[model samples]
Target: MPASISMDENMGFQYGVSRPGLNPPIQFGNGFYGAGSGLIRGGLGAYGKKICGSSSQYVQSNISKYFSDPQYYFQVNSHYVGNKLKIILFPFLHRGHWTRMTEPVGGRLSYNPPITDIHAPDLYIPFMTFATYLVLAGISLGLSGKFSPEAINWQFVKGMVGWLLQVMLLKASLSSLGGGEAPLLDMIAYTGYTFTGLCVAVLGRITLSYAYYLIIIWTSMCSGIFLAKTIKITLYAEINSYDANMHHYLLLAFPRNSNPKPRDSQNRRETISLIQKCKQFHQVPPIHAKIIRYFQVQDPFVVFELLRLCSNLNSIDHATKIFQQIQTPNVYLYTALINGFVSTGFCLDAIRVYCRMDNESVSPDNYAVTSVLKACGFGLALEEGRGVHAQVLKLGLSSNRSVRMKLLNLYGKCGEFEHARRVFDEMPDRDVVASTVMITSFADYGLIEEAIGVFNRARSKDTVC
Candidate 1:
């Protein structure tokens, strides 16, 4: 028989005393409690395991999404390391393309890694250099008879702090400079590059002692130059509005030298020399402007140099004014002005300059023709490009490889695939580059099948395709 049970206020359950004719009261055993608790514990453990696993995966995915793939930054090879080191120490000497290489993957453009592209940033050098810096500091401490584990640990801490500060500073700078959307890993890699120069400075201090000052200054200068140039090309490439101002900042950062007088009497030689010097030093355009104003130089050669410099600086207006100063512009001077306008992205102005040259009866050279063709391509001036092509044939430049290539590019960019194909067929030497260009142009216009046909029919094939 069951025992009579009543609820108690303090205790959850209480067994009442057995009444007459009632069977012995049932006992509440420990097994009951143990089984009940075990059920709850097992359920909770399974739930908690599932929650932890899902939450950890969520956090990891979020981190990866925010920071990008860290593996991309660490993919460096020996050749890439060597070239990267060279760039860090002598940025001005690097003449290769500053933009990263991209390939089509899953129908989207993905940038190649440092192993495949020299322009792509990496983390390997910076990490190694930081370690080297710490080691060098330890060596210095040993030389001074102050070596200790505590001292080495402190150095490590300090180095880490400095690295963090540099990263923060670079991230902030880029944010304010209109590159806030840049990847976090890229910023880290770029800022870490400072350690390379830091390592060099420490080594110099340990070795030379006396020239430590000089070495530090030089290394600092090189590092500044490297960062400025790299940021200029990589981050600022698309910020057209900020490009001129960025050039100004870079101009200020470059080292200065005393001005030199023009060498010859006519000042043509000296004027050209001065322009070259300014170009080399990255002197401000105003300095050249002042020179042009003071010297009142009129030589076509000097004017051409001035136009070239202005073009390089993307100052097409200044280049136009310089061109106006030439009363009777020669072919070279016209070509220089056209090239400047083309380079500065003033495609319409370049076309107008080409027209003006034609009106002035200045014959277009191969360079002038090519520059005008490029301008037409960029401006999408199909009719203008056709006119330039006619001029090319009339001037007997059709056989010129560069001219032919420009013609092919102009037609392809304008979506004139038939013309482009005709030009390709007529090419006496359809090398890999020309064929690749044709195939790429077709592919760009969504002619994948055509591209494949061109590839199959090609006389020679290479990996570049």
Candidate 2:
């Protein structure tokens, strides 16, 4: 017999009496026995009765039973009781219980209920990996500060506040959904912890002041990682659904009606037509060859199209080769390359492209400047960002809204609130962007009241609500 069965039997006899008042005495055969045999049998019997009959045992069994066949206990107090306790005590640990309780009640409980797999490598690994990256970022930023003091600004604090708000929003949304049992406090704590790690990384990358940038970097990194993961999971689920396939095809066929002239209309039409034709005809030219033929004219737009297509196909080398072959690459061409590099998380490469533009004496335009600034942000190149800022001032581009906004953002990111404020004050007109930058700065410094005041003032103005 199985050990559990044997133990149960032994327990059944030792605690044979069903009621507390009743007692059943037994006499064992007189024989040489092992040490403590009577004690062992007695203990086993007592445990069996407790497991099988005690009020606590009954409650546990009922709870598990109700969970297995929820309809049987749909109106039972035990279900609610168990769920309430789980929510209060285990929070994040009992996500499934909360999910099940929230599901529509009429049908038989799902055999394989939808549950988020928390142990998936992607869920936790990226946060940890990015934590290391954050440390590096902090180091890099710290080093960059030696040359670029202006890189540190108030916007970093504001960005940090925005990040914190996002985290709170996410947690609230999750709790509102099926995550009532999710320990929100713990989630917030972990997020803060992760954020700190990232801030350290950013500090290591560039230096303005360790204290403020550290917080901003930490929060930004953690929040960014969490949001990215959540979005990816949601997208994966949506894309994997049967309905999504039909919708995807429909979207491709009809396309959105936003752009006046869809930028890639011809290419899209061809790609879609090619897919449909492939279904009917087995033999067709490779997609690349077709694309090459389609763009035979060598127009800058065509080159851009080919570059975009190649990058989408993960043929970066091919995209680079085509980019190099252009006789006279314009600012747009360089912007495309820079954007492509940034998209691929190659901040260093993007910076190099900006440097090349400088060497060629091609006065980097607004778009180019924006892209390079983004690179500086990513690489934590405070000095480079300051240099760019100086150039913007020299070129009288400081008045340009986009350039000024970027400068505000760059300064804030580097943890220089005063400089960020200076930029904000220098704006020709106080727009929503400028106000938001100021509000964010206050929030980053944990001056919630001040941030709210700014927001209220902006709302009262009603200029750009």
Candidate 3:
């Protein structure tokens, strides 16, 4: 008989294989197992269960936040539809406020429903307008004696293509101009407003074909004006909060449509406040002369903020001078300076800063490591990347996800897939993102089968993978 096994109440098992001799009594229980085929299935099953349970929980928590609930976009009423249509067709005539209404709920400000807020976006009008366009197109075709199922299908396809182009153009424009974090569905709704104008233009063509050109142009202008106003309002709502001084400065520097006229006393006060804020600064070195002179600021954190701003403005030289004024910089300051260099396409300068931080005996954190690794990847500095990898190991940051991902990215960009694979394999829990990265690396290098193999071996797969 096989060795008698005693199962404890706590799921532990004691094997009586060691009967005074052979192999010093094999033991298989409490998460430790001796070499044996009998316990293989049970151990594998237990491990698989733990992994799947954790993976399921993790995916549920993370993925849910990414995809928005569509129900919010569809909550509409007839009054909203009427008001929304008017705004789309005649936006300039709109006398009401453009700001979205909000209400307090659960200690946070939540936007009011579309039924009550005229400025709020909804899918109801878009869907109705799209259907009306399709119907009108069918009628126009029938009137022209060219009506066919295929023609309707083609018109539908055309309309969809136009809608997609609108969305893509709007999204791309927002990305280029920055500060438009409108939801994907909101973009869809905004773009879909074009269909409302299209419906009227199509109706005009069906009724009075001779005046089609005039009608189309008029509708186009109206649509353009409406969209400009709507998108401007949307962008304005997405502005992040800033300190009062920064807010006043921005208003004075770049007045908006809603900015109070400079003739008003209140507006004058705001301008004066901004000037006073600027007057607080003392004259510094010519290198850090421009904005730094206006803000008499010596705090390293403030300098870091200005450094980021200068980088955004493509004034890296000014940022460097400001950085030099700091007597001692922390990891955040170092990371900011490195990031500024990286953003401004000065990868070598970023690497030098990282090295300088190291030379100063300041222990670099994961953020600094990731920033330099990005510089290495962009500059294709394999040797420098390897040195950073060594530092990562020494600093015990090899286990950090961001650090590892950056290292993997650095190696892959430098055509060092072998090292990338080694880094990938060392990860204890390879999530979808890590697997996707490995697969992408393999595919990029023409290793098709290797990419498929990595995908197949992934314990958890998601749409992203």
Candidate 4:
């Protein structure tokens, strides 16, 4: 038996090292210290991966909302990204910053700050950091006399592959946890953050090879902590909300009575609201019939809703039938009919309807002009639209914001830069939308300098250009 050894009550072997001048070293029973330490390390590594994976899962679960546009994800709102790359590399050292949540609507990108945002998952940082890391890494390799383009390319590919693996792991973990349905690109953004941390380690290696290991340790710890904390906070609701709302969509198709009965004001409002929600859904044939039954075939508003929805759905023929049923169509209904025709490639039909309105001497509202001009633009009949512009001027509506924008859009599309610029210049009050339209027009026409000039001279910094 080894000296300075004892058996414990639990049957764990206790050992003590005999030092020349000490009674004995402190006892470590059985595999107490060794096994515990090993287990702790294993648990930490597994837990780190698990938490990080959950973080990815939470993001991807809302993938359509978050990851519909890859460009939007990679695009950093200047307001949010300003002076944050340095801090992003060492996120633990600098807390309390968030990335922008952005969406592209009608060819314009809008940004909003997330209610519970963490900065690490910003695609801007990942994209920029990945590029910068590769550049810095190449420089390091070059300095060490081991530079090769092939090797640098390999590193880039390897990093991307690693990011992909992280996304897979995250997606798999979340799916297993009953939260699978996250966006693929959102997962890409989250997993892609490795570049930010790896960038720091690469810089350290460039400075001193020994520093690489130390910085890597720091970076790994920081990543684990950030992901774990953020995941717990962000996904707590997401997991539960997802489950609760799992049946929400199925419930949308509530049991429709064999015949929808006319109800009270509250019921009518709810029916209209529900119809509005269902407008985007592809199953509109039944919905249209349901709306007619609900209104008992006398509500112009019901017809208006169906018309507008049919336009969006490109059901131009159906909308025309609904339009015919309206005994007295208001400007809103008229505009909806025109918009439906134009949106669904029935620009000629839209124009004929406008001519009929003119014959009937129906006063064309701003929406009417906007819809007609848009129809002209879609039809590529710039000359006809110019005549419509003349009518708009005669009606003293050129000053209308929407009219000017629609007219400007028309001229820009027709390759009439001079006309487009003239309208934009003549606007009494140029807002962000006007500026955005002008810049977009200039860009499309290959007038890069003009676009840049407009961008620089904009009074409002909020323009999408």
lDDT of each candidate versus the true structure: 0.66, 0.48, 0.64, 0.61
lDDT of 2 at 356: 55
The residue ranges of model 4 lying beyond 4 angstroms of the native Cα positions read 1-274, 277-298, 452-456, 459-465
lDDT (tens digit, per residue) of candidate 4 on 378-446: 655565577678788888998888899999998887778899989988987777788888888889889
lDDT of 2 by residue, 139-228 (tens): 465665632334333334544575478558766665453323333332333344343345444554354454655666555555455445
- 332-351, model 1: which lDDT tens digit per residue? 98888778766654454565
TM-score of each: 0.42, 0.37, 0.42, 0.39
Q: Is candidate 2 or candidate 4 better by TM-score?
A: 4
After TM-score superposition, the amount by which residue 179's alpha carbon in candidate 4 deviates from its true location, in angstroms, is 50
lDDT at 40 for candidate 4? 32
Best by TM-score: 1
Candidate 3 displacement at residue 70 in angstroms: 1.8
Stretches > 4 Å off in candidate 2: 1-298, 310-317, 445-453, 463-465
Candidate 4 global lDDT: 0.61
- Clash-forming residue pairs, model 4: 60-182, 60-183, 61-182, 63-183
Q: Determine which window of 10 residues in candidate 4 has minimal summed lDDT.
A: 1-10
Residue 31 of model 4 has an lDDT of 16
